[model samples]
Target: MSTSPVTLLTEDDSWEFLRTQSVGRLATAVGGEAEIFPVSFAAGDGVVYFRTRPGTKLVELTVNSRVAFEADEWGEDVATSVVVKGTARILETDAELAAARGTGLVSFQNDDKNVWVSITPTEVSGRRIARG
Candidate 1:
C-alpha cells in the first residue's frame, strides 16, 4: 500500500476539479430516501448544468430543491473527490433553455432532453489523497 496522506482541497482547486469533469453523481432526496444518479454535466462559473428527460429526476427536483453533487478523479498514486451542496432549479425561460443548449450538455442515455436543471451550489468541498 502506498503511504499517502489526505489533504483538504482549496476552494479554487475544488472548482477547478469540478470543471474538469463531465460526468458526476447527482444526489437528491425522494420521499425521505436519498437517491443518486449519474449524469453528464457542463461546469463553469459556480453553476453545474445537466440535461434530463422529463421523468422522475425532474419530479424529484421539484419535490426537493436541495441536492448534493459529486465528481472524482483517480490516478495511480493520487485521488480526489469534490462534493457540492446546492439547490436544483429547472430552466423555464426560453433564454435559459437556449443558453443551456449552447453549452452542449448531454445526457448519458439516448433520450430527448426536454428539461435542463441548473444546480447552484451553496457550498463546495473537496479532498485529495496523494502518496507521501
Candidate 2:
C-alpha cells in the first residue's frame, strides 16, 4: 500500500504559489459577524492586492482590518492550499496606487471596481499533498 505525500510550504514558497493564482477568498469579521467573498487578486512583494467597490466586503473590512485570505490549486496528482492572515487597508497614497496598478489584477465583475485593497500578511502558511 502507498500513502500520499504531504509537505508544508515555506513562506517564500507560499507567496510564490500565491503569485500564480488569481482568485481567492477574502475573509473578514466585524461585530461578531464573519463574511467571506471571492476576489480576484495579485500577489507580490509579500502582499496581496484586490479591487472592489463600496459594498459589504469593503464595509466589513473597514470596521475590522484583520482578515484572512485563501487561494488553492490542484493538479492531476497533487493539491495545494495557501492561507494568509493579515491586515487589510484601502489604498490612498499615490505611490501605493501606482504600485497596485503595476500588479495587473483583473476584476471578474463587470461592475466598476475602482477601490484597491492591500492585504499585508502577518502570517502565511500552505501545504501540498499528493494523491495516493
Candidate 3:
C-alpha cells in the first residue's frame, strides 16, 4: 500500500472544515487511564457542543475539564484530520440551553441525552493526508 504525504492545514481551513462536521472523538484522561468517546457535536462560535446521557463522560469531565477533541474527513484519495484541545463543561444555564436548542446536533443512538456538554477550544490544528 502506498502512503500519502501529510500537509499541515491552516487555521482558517481547519476551522472551516470543522464547521462542516457533526461528529468527533472526545479524549479524556483521568487518574491512570484515558478514554475516548464518539460524540455527535455541533461546531459554532469557536466551540463544539454535544448531548449525552449521564455516564463516564460526565463523571470524567467533572473530574478533569481538560480534554482533546478530534474530527476528520476522509476519502479514498485524501483525508483530513482536525484536533482541538479544549476545556469541557456541562451547560447549566437557561441561556446556554436556549442557544443550543436548534444546533441540529442529534444523537445516533436511542439514548436519553439530557446533559449538554460544550468544549471550548484553546488550540485548533489539522493536517491533510493526500496523494501527491
Candidate 4:
C-alpha cells in the first residue's frame, strides 16, 4: 500500500491519535549518530510529555532540544503513522511536573521520580495506507 502526505493534523486528530497511543519512539542525535528510543508518553495542548532517567541521551536532549517522535499502528495490509518534529524541554516548574504526573500514562514504575521531558511540536504529519 502507498501513502500520501497530508497537511498537519488538526487539533482534534492530533489529540485523538496521541491519546490513543501509549508509546512512541523518540529520535535524536547521539554522538553525531541517529538514535531512537521507545518511550511511553502523554499528549495534550500541543505538547507531548514523557519521563526518562538521567543519562547521556538526557544530557544530549538538554543540550540539543530538537527531536522527532513517531507513533503508529498496523494491521493486515494497512498501517497508519504520525510523526512530530519539535523542540523538547525539561519540565522543571512544579506546575509542569504536576501536569506531567497528571497524564496517568506512565508505563515505567518510577516515572514520577524521573525527569520529565516535554515536546512542543513545531510540525506534525500523518499518513495512512491507501486502499488498493
The TM-score values for the models, in the order shown, are: 0.88, 0.94, 0.90, 0.83
lDDT of 2 by residue, 39-61 (tens): 99999789999999998999898
What's the lDDT of the predicted structure labeled candidate 1?
0.88
lDDT of 3 at 119: 88
Determine the C-alpha RMSD for candidate 2 after optimal superposition of all C-alphas. Answer: 1.5
TM-score of 2: 0.94
Q: List the candidate 2 regions with Cα displacement exceeding 4 Å.
A: 1-4
How do the residues 9-74 of candidate 4 rate in per-residue lDDT, one tens digit apiece? Answer: 665676688888989999998568888888889887678898888886698797788999998877
**RMSD to native, candidate 1:** 2.6
Give model 3's TM-score versus the native structure.
0.90
- List candidate 4 segments past 4 Å from native: 1-11, 108-113
> Higher lDDT: candidate 2 or 4?
2
Model 3, range 5-69, lDDT digits (tens) per residue? Answer: 99888988888898889888999999978999999888877778899888899999999999999
**In model 4, what are the clashing residue pairs, if there are any?**
none
Top-TM-score candidate index: 2
Better by lDDT, candidate 3 or 1: 3
* Weakest 10 consecutive residues of candidate 3 by summed lDDT: 101-110
What lDDT does the true structure give each of the candidates?
A: 0.88, 0.93, 0.88, 0.81
At residue 16, candidate 2 shows an lDDT of 93
Q: State residue 83's C-alpha deviation in candidate 4, in Å.
A: 0.6
Per-residue C-alpha lDDT of model 1 across residues 31-96, encoded as one tens digit per residue: 889999899998766788898877888889999999999999899999999999999999989987
In model 3, the clashing pairs are none
- For model 4, state the Cα shift of residue 59 in Å: 1.5
